[model samples]
Target: MRHLHIRTPRRRVIGALAAGLLCTTGLAAPALAAPTAEPAAPTLADGLALTPPMGFNNWNSTHCRAEFNESMVEGIADLFVDKGLKDAGYQYVNLDDCWALPARDADGKLVPDPVRFPHGIKAVADYVHAKGLKLGIYTSAGTKTCNSAGFPGALGHEYSDAQQFADWGVDYLKYDNCNNQGVDAKLRYTTMRDALKATGRPIVYSICEWGENKPWEWASDVGHLWRTTGDISDSWGSMLSILKQNLPLSAHAGPGHWNDPDMLEVGNGGMTDTEYRTHFSMWSVMAAPLLIGSDLRKASDATFDVLGNKEVIAVDQDPLGKQGTVLSSEGGRWVVAKEMKDGSRAVALFNETGSPQHIATTARAAGLPEAGAYTLRDLWQHRSYNTAGTIAATVPAHGTVLVRVSAGGRWATRPPAVELGLDGSPLVQAGRTAALTSKVTDLGRTPATHLSVTLAGPAGWTVKAISPTTAGLLPTGRSLRTKWQVTAPGSTATGSYDLTLRARYRSLTGTRVESVLPLKATVVVAPPAGVSSLGDLPWLSTTNGWGPVERNTSNGESAAGDGRPITLGGVEFAKGLGVHAESAVEYYTGAACETVTADVGVDDEKGARGTVAFEIWADGTKVASTGVLTNAMPAQPVTADVSGAQVVRLVVTDGGDGIDSDHADWADAKLMC
Candidate 1:
């Protein structure tokens, strides 16, 4: 089930922590240690999941669809062996929801759906076990499961369900949060934990309370992994927002317990390959569970490549168990470093902008000991380079450059750290020549000699050097800038095209070094020079708290086209968009839009129950906002001057309260160019 994005009371969180500490140590309140005496965080007694559990979960790709049956699960088990994922350390083949009957059996035990599992769950578990893999199952903490079908959950029947799961040879349990009947979060979860232990099975307990009770602060001893955020959608904005939420809890993750930020979305088809790489890389660096959330039967080769990157996975499964911390974050450029068991550090230079940016971090800053030189191994490209101390790259838009750095030995012979970047916006029209400037800098101590740089684009594109491209010698910290004119073919489609910058130089030891950097250039068609309805244009991206954003309708329910006419305070409108709270719709304006206007308010579909706020963003800056609108209020007009803005974003946020029935409408939305 989808989780609610809300914060727990601070008093509750603090009380829970104190209570958990006391419970774990079995001490009375007065007999506990003083506040100054920092007690060790309690860990699960079961020695399972020494590293974050690597496996597959079917929720993201199939959800509770008809395809999520016994054969599909057995097929996934086969893929784990056939696709080399078993060797890569993926063990669990899990079912998410809709696996059980609507009600318990005569013995008050869960029953596998006969249609979905004709041979029973135990048979499927046997099939997976025969492949040398394990099996995981899902249930909720309440009387009913999360889906609308209302399958039987394991709440009051914890002991019976736990015994049944053990009888079925279950290796893992994903206990979700839904219909929980206001029971104490700790009590409900601790009961299940005790029940699982009593079964004498090593079932990995995944607490899926969605951080509503601040699980990370006190769930170390409760479960193997605890979700730290709401459900994750397969989109760049969703991934980025979840990453920001989970990055602050690095201290709560350790060897047997992890701060789960949900599952992987690498092959979900909702993001680019570059964005998928960043997803995989960031998740790996965070020491998160490497649960593959995509359907394997239809996975593309590229998707499998990202999922099977052993080097990246190694960082996640490192025995050191230290979650990565943010070395630095500024203007959407983040440097995260994780200390490895081998004394090396896995560093990720991430660019969250719309253009390429040069992100760098020093070895000292990455917690490495002082050494003469550092070996920088590109985990994605699988190449090695030597740097004096600087680890940097011109990371592409919505991309990440992950590298593992160690010191000494062969790395003592330093190679020039060539940093490459493109000047100005990398956007051009089809068949038009764009003057692109490539700046190369040497960040090494010794000078680089016989340095030459060349630029290459796609096959149909033409690139001509407009300035000097060769240099005899480049001193330390010196930059060599060259200009080039790149022209795309007239038939070039309106999409992102890749350009490569190759540089070659000689180090002080007379060893030749080569570096290749990739850049992305987009070809766009500006909006027509007139007023146009926003619903008529294609959105660059969208993220919603509930279902898909609807056009010319009210936020009816949780599915697309379930909406009705856009209505606010009983006034119906024929146009504009309808969305839930915490929603964002982004459009590429190409710096051609001047004004955006909309009538905003909470949709009447929720009566007078919803509260929301509408905001207009030009680029990254908020240009206009409608202060807290409720369903009882009439539509309010909002106008924002978005001149010279390359992208315009529409945002709707929960208004102070929680996002319950937060059906917001942007009626009669229009953009003027």
Candidate 2:
């Protein structure tokens, strides 16, 4: 059996858990216990409060082995107060790793490195206090810190270290977890947390565990804010990937307990200003910590802009700080909407593809209204515009347009809506078979006659209607329509399955809507004997649908689509480019396999429809083919056949004016299989 390891910082863990205890569960929850015993004074939880915490970390500027002094700490403090950052809501001047001596003294006490902090931490704290700012320090939860050099270690010294910091008048502790053992990580972290609580000082705890474990779920029970992703490098790919990881974890964040997705790398010289704005915007939306990980002394004007976008910061610092989620993505265009307090909506349109794309959202989709236009603002450009009843705008390549929506007048306009309803009955198990009974209704409370319904079932499940066996349109009065039927399929695999019912109304307006619900039905089949548990199924990357675009080529070719050399007969497809054909089809391979359904985002830029073909092979035999078609937008993920394909092949034609120069980028080529 493979074991999982987790490392958590002590002060962060404790403060987070304390905040979690403050929230009230739903009506059926048990009554809370009054605090008969107060643990200790608590430090302020950064993101849970009215303003976001601002600070300068040492990692970006001074790595390990940098000298520290009262002047250095006080100099930065003076800059913070001088530049009005503290008045602008920036507090806490933090020192990152590598400030301690090589080893503890004979008494097992941690001491500052004589060469680095000659005056010790107390003098440093006093210096910071004199400048009217709080002082912060760093340490690792593991025996060996991330730094190559071992210094001021906290292993088997949690309680003693907490007392040491308390005695030094430390206001904040930035706890890090690096090079720690798995079994010891969690326990070690908890020890620090409990030890910190034992101290009387109110010190804010910032947990930095590189997100090895899913800390957002439980870190709240321990720290004020905990990192939810791995360390972010000074690169765009790293920044974007980190933000993407934070997207689904939004539900786990709130005011007191935040999901820290590491620190900001905006001022670092790796990304452009526009990309940095997107970075900040997304972070604000995710409500992740805004700890600046750059040198504050010499930051550029553009860097300052990113750190000081008042309008964008407003969303981040909103009293009702809530994270957002992706609603939908189509044709390289995606709509991510967040519900805000005061009955307003925050929406962002992202164009992940190479070309410009138009994106729009309706009030219903945004959970707003059936009527009323809304005021719109372009956050990046800092411009405000009116939006029609339906919000529509064009987004640039690899760019995003974010807007806030509320009731308004004279924005762009769209006609009123046509309502449609889809109904599906829950699935239930009956001995050896699975039964599904469903109904379709024109629940839109309108006098509409024609509506079509499309139902999507789980993979490996076959559907055969037992009653009202026609799969098509149902006609109900303008105000109502209904279609009812029963379905039965037999299988053993049971967990949870998603059922989708799509209703499209073809009228002057041509309205289409979808309804999806989950059915919980248990299966009677038992696992094969001797089975302790089931492991995750294998997934193919090519079938995944969207991935990075390979180089464009005419002659150079290889065997696999994964940038690996494979044996091919006459012609081969390597990455997104195709080689010359000589009597053999272009055979491209996938990264992994044994998947049924996959998302395929094709560039098809050559307008080369029917010129290229996608053949899905399962266990070395062709199972299905997706007919060739050119979709101008390369970013949109298209549904493709992996249905039974263990390994899939994509063959692009080397024929005619092939997508001349534009490179096709596949966002996430993944197989649902």
Highest lDDT against the true fold, candidate: 1
The best candidate in terms of TM-score: 1
Could you give me the TM-score of model 2 versus the true structure? 0.55
Candidate 2 lDDT tens digits, 1-673: 0111211111112222221110000000011112213222233443333334556666655455343444566677887787666665667778776667778889988888667778888888887788778877888776656555555547678899999998888877777765454434457667777888799777777776755555664566577777765555554434544555566666666666677777787787656565577677777776666767667677898888778776666667666766666666644366777777666777777654322345677656877775544556556656444333455554443456676766654333321223222332133332334444444432221222244445555565555455542323433223233333323355444333445544444322343333332223322222222211111221111111112223332221122343322112222233223222101121112223234332222333323221223333433344554443233323323344443332343322212211212122222233342
Per-residue lDDT over 321-393 for candidate 1, one digit per residue giving the tens place of the 0 to 100 score = 9888887776567899999999999999988665677789899999999987778888998877677789888
Name model 2 segments beyond 4 Å from true: 1-52, 65-73, 369-371, 408-673
Model 2 collision count: 39
Please report how far candidate 2 places residue 219 from its true position, in Å.
2.2
Model 1 lDDT, full chain set: 0.81
Ten-residue segment with the worst summed lDDT in candidate 2? 20-29
Q: What are the models' TM-scores?
A: 0.83, 0.55
